[model samples]
Target: MRVTPPFAPVTDHDLAVLAEQLGRPARGVIGIAARCVCGNPTVVATAPRLADGSPFPTFYYLTHPAATAAMSRLEATHVMAELADELAADPELQAGHLRAHHAYLADRARYGDVPEIAGISAGGMPTRVKCLHALAGHALAGGPGVNPIGDAALARGDWSPQRCACARPGPMLDAAGVAE
Candidate 1:
């Protein structure tokens, strides 16, 4: 198997947790891509194609409510637009985004191929800055330098993965969305 996303094995508990985090059943998730300090899944690595056989382009999916909200806030404030301008002005940033895009594709390639999603990386990689959530997910899954836009988004966001913001799997909220 190819090394990818730190490879956190999936479990029934994980699936349940993801379902609650997503506010629905978490579909097409292959493994936990990143975790909160409390060990809850922050990001999940999804298959290029869902079980239903539909093409799913996003691989690293951010599920943490706090993190997702943070990214959304940044987007609301037009951080993506500012990042896009930076990407356009800085050659180094552009190159990093290109590399990030390739890395995303390579990581997804390890799972399985979906022709419909060929050459497509999430978060508007390689040219655009459309989604901070996607970029942040990639950054969280791959770590610092893997996705420049992701890293930048994380840096600017108020949320920090270093701290435990997870609701915790208990009466608080577990994968089943209920207390054990």
Candidate 2:
């Protein structure tokens, strides 16, 4: 099932929130692909070609700090090799991954086609599980079942979309007993 929703235009407030989360200005952000439970952006959909005219295959970029940390931890364990082994052994998984590759391409095409990366998808998809971060980002943006490898990585990881792990304060209390 292709779970990637249509892109929603980025707003200035969304960019501000992203900048705060990333500790740098957000660039080439076309839309917010996924949001935290507290409504902050968790995944951003970026243009295939950056402003400087470089080909960036990572269309669904994970931005939530907690989620990124979780993916990084998984990567540190060298889980990609294990997952790559599984991918090689499972025919169903290989088919699902190919579908995900096509889905990723379709998603990137919406932003504008960049011929340099026409057949390429992020995270070494369809043939290898190279980057947990990119796969996890795709899972977050496309939701549960779209990318099998991505979904598996998310399931194996510690972070979840169901809960809010945002560093920002929630409903701050003011002296007047009103939320700030």
Candidate 3:
């Protein structure tokens, strides 16, 4: 989609400040660069150069023009969507991230206080609100997802023991105490 910079008027004071920051001669070049960054044709498009006819050391602050522009609600939403798309595309990375998230959440569920409304089905508002309330117990407790075990670890220096999968206490017991 063809995106435009968010519309905002710049004053002479703003231009002066930008030029001072750019450290170039006061020829409005920095203003043009800002415009270019803001996705505007206002920039005079000759390659940036030093006063002595040498190339500028770096194309300082190279960024998507739209992003550099004055942010608007629509532009911000579009940028957020772009970032989300970038995050979602790589399956391996996404899976790894989700695995970490699942581990974190599962750990929280195990050792943390269960939310009062944990069992609401995912559907409409009542369900959603209830599910949200279920998660909100952490915040109500303090911050989000403060697990008792993790808290205990910090407070009492009680680290969880590592269990080797190959080693069992005995034959795996049933849900009850019956041997399985």
Per-residue accuracy of model 3 over 71-123 as CA lDDT, tens digit each:
23323345334423434665543443333233333322332233442331111
Candidate lDDT scores, in order, read 0.86, 0.84, 0.27
Candidate 2 residue spans exceeding 4 A from truth: 1-5, 169-180
- Give the lDDT ranking, best first: 1, 2, 3
Tens-digit lDDT track of model 2 for 1-180: 464747767767678889998999998998888877666788999889999999989999999999999989888887777889999999999998888888888888877889999899999987888888888888888877788898988888899988888888234324332335
Number of clashing pairs per prediction, in order: 2, 0, 0
- What is the RMSD, in Å, between candidate 3 and the native fold over all Cα? 27.1
lDDT string, candidate 1, 113-179, tens digits:
8988999989898799989999999999888888888999999999998887777732333444333
Estimate candidate 3's alpha-carbon lDDT, on a 0 to 1 scale: 0.27
The estimated TM-scores of all candidates read: 0.91, 0.90, 0.21
Model 3 lowest lDDT segment of ten: 121-130
Local error of candidate 2 at residue 91 (angstroms): 0.6
TM-score attained by model 3: 0.21
Task: Give the lDDT of residue 13 in candidate 3.
Answer: 40
